[model samples]
Target: MDDYQRLVVAQFFESLPNLSPELCHQFVLRHIVPALLPKTTSKVDVQPSAFQGSMSYTAILHIHSTHGGHRIVVQFRTEKQDLSGVTEASCIHGSIVPLVTYQGMYEELFVYTSPFAEGTPYISVLTSSDDFELPLWKKMAIVMDLADLVTRGARANNVPPDTAIVELTTTLDKTQHAVNDYAFQNISVRTSISACVSYVLSQLHNIVTLPLTLTHQDLSPFNYLIDLSTGNVKAVLDWDGALYLPVGSNFHFLDSLFGFMTLKGWQDADDRHELEAAFYDRALDSLAAQGYKGITKEKLELQKAIGMLLYGVERLLKSKDEHSEHYLDGYLRGLSFMKEPISSSY
Candidate 1:
């Protein structure tokens, strides 16, 4: 092959090493080039076959698409074979269980390669057989567990409740006041956010502190997988947002409340409203009962302000995709619930 042809051939081989020359070239021309090429290459149409495997308690499945050409999405399912005498459904992600096989304690949780895509490959339960769906109240219980987990975890890590609250608020307010066209990092929402948050921290200089624990900063439904049968949370996914040390306060409640609100917004005008309210109430009560003594009225008010700001910022950063926009809108409304000053009705 000439120099130009050789260069193209070498590049193609590097893209997908296992495939034969013809197949590699086909994959390249069909998926790679069109994706990488300037607005010139033609798009091809094809769907690749999917592969699946089953181990002791888990099953792995991977789906490929030659046309869409996204990353290989693999799914792991825990088969829970010992369901004979169990009163409730059993789940095994992020749990401290003894290892019975190659899937380590964490492996049972989830680990897979996902390069820029929605719905990363991961484990989920068999929803079809059990017809599993947690009622609103039960779901709220899970949210509360999450909130306490975060609050305790943060305090243990030496994050003063006040600082945590301030930073959290600043991040939110900055995001909300940001103009739509302005980019977030510079003229970004983070600017004003940092300022307000800084002021809050200055005011709450003396709060008792403890060592920090793990903070799952993004505890939204997208990252959490809930077991509907027992009202248990199976896994807390995506630690990418987790932070260590004292950033003042932990922002764990941010996500759970957002999740609660999204669910609330979807309720039917009549029945759904009541159900959603019950869910939110349960979660708030549960958080309060579980030692999440979030300072005073002023602190709580700041949390709401920052929380709303954060929501707006979050919404502004949302993708223009259909599903993304839909979810963002729901979460934004959820954030709204926290914005109001004290109200007799929750």
Candidate 2:
């Protein structure tokens, strides 16, 4: 481990004061090895990684023996990390989610493991796949899985709707402040960005009042997997910051399937095919088929708009530097509808 790696590990074990590397080693030998490999003794290789996600300290375990080899991923939650309603998520999401074969706590750290799922992250697929051949069905498959996540994971183990709305409202308000700050610093985009945000905020109630579901907080390419051949979903990874919010909160990511984001905004794949209407039709139909009725086309349009607006602003605020700012500027510029007002019935 380098200096930064040492620092990362040191920071992680701060909360687990009683959990040293030695303890983790022994625990793996006594508990994990037996549980995973059974009575036969195996050469256990515990590799502590610098690969920590937004919520946990992660490590890799390689167990080799006469039978075979097993590679497992281990994660220890930080003190502030809250995976409050995620225990049932795997079962809810089925094989499309990483399977957690083991989980337990030690020295106040929430630790768990999943047998490594074999597939490339969706980001990699998009980045390397040939000739921009990302088909529409792959995008639809992801949306279908999302519909399943929404209907099956409905309200179960979710935060109270009112409370969830309050939290979401706080986030929107914070973004409003951030936008104001950004506009104050960069006067060039001030008026246009401000007006767009104002339009979104003015129509925000339409977004908050829709059906509530577990919103995957981070819906980036890095968090999901796609098959290279059929382009279907392989697995959805890292449910750490999952929260309860109105449907379509995660819809912003659905665009990446049919389009690619450049420094200049969302450019449609294969040049001119924007599939938003197709997605909404499939999603609404899926919801109705699953007995989650009452979703009108009007509501879904508003959901997509509000979700995209909220997410775009979030990326703008979370942008680390001017390179990111340029990319965001292009993305926001393409959202011409945000500048147009919506008739709110909420």
For model 2, the stretches where C-alpha displacement exceeds 4 angstroms are 1-38, 42-70, 76-80, 99-111, 131-140, 147-152, 155-174, 183-193, 202-208, 263-266, 271-274, 304-315, 318-320, 330-336, 339-346
Q: Give per-residue lDDT, candidate 1, residue 285.
A: 51
lDDT scores for all predictions? 0.37, 0.62
Candidate 1, which ten residues in sequence have the lowest lDDT sum? 84-93
Residue 36 of candidate 1: its Cα lDDT? Answer: 39
| Tens digit per residue, CA lDDT, model 2, 114-186 | 8676666676666556644566676666656554554455542245546655775676677667777774334
How far out, in Å, is residue 296 in model 2?
A: 3.5
lDDT of 2: 0.62
Mind sharing the TM-score for model 2? 0.70
Using all chains and alpha carbons, the TM-scores for the candidates as numbered come to: 0.41, 0.70
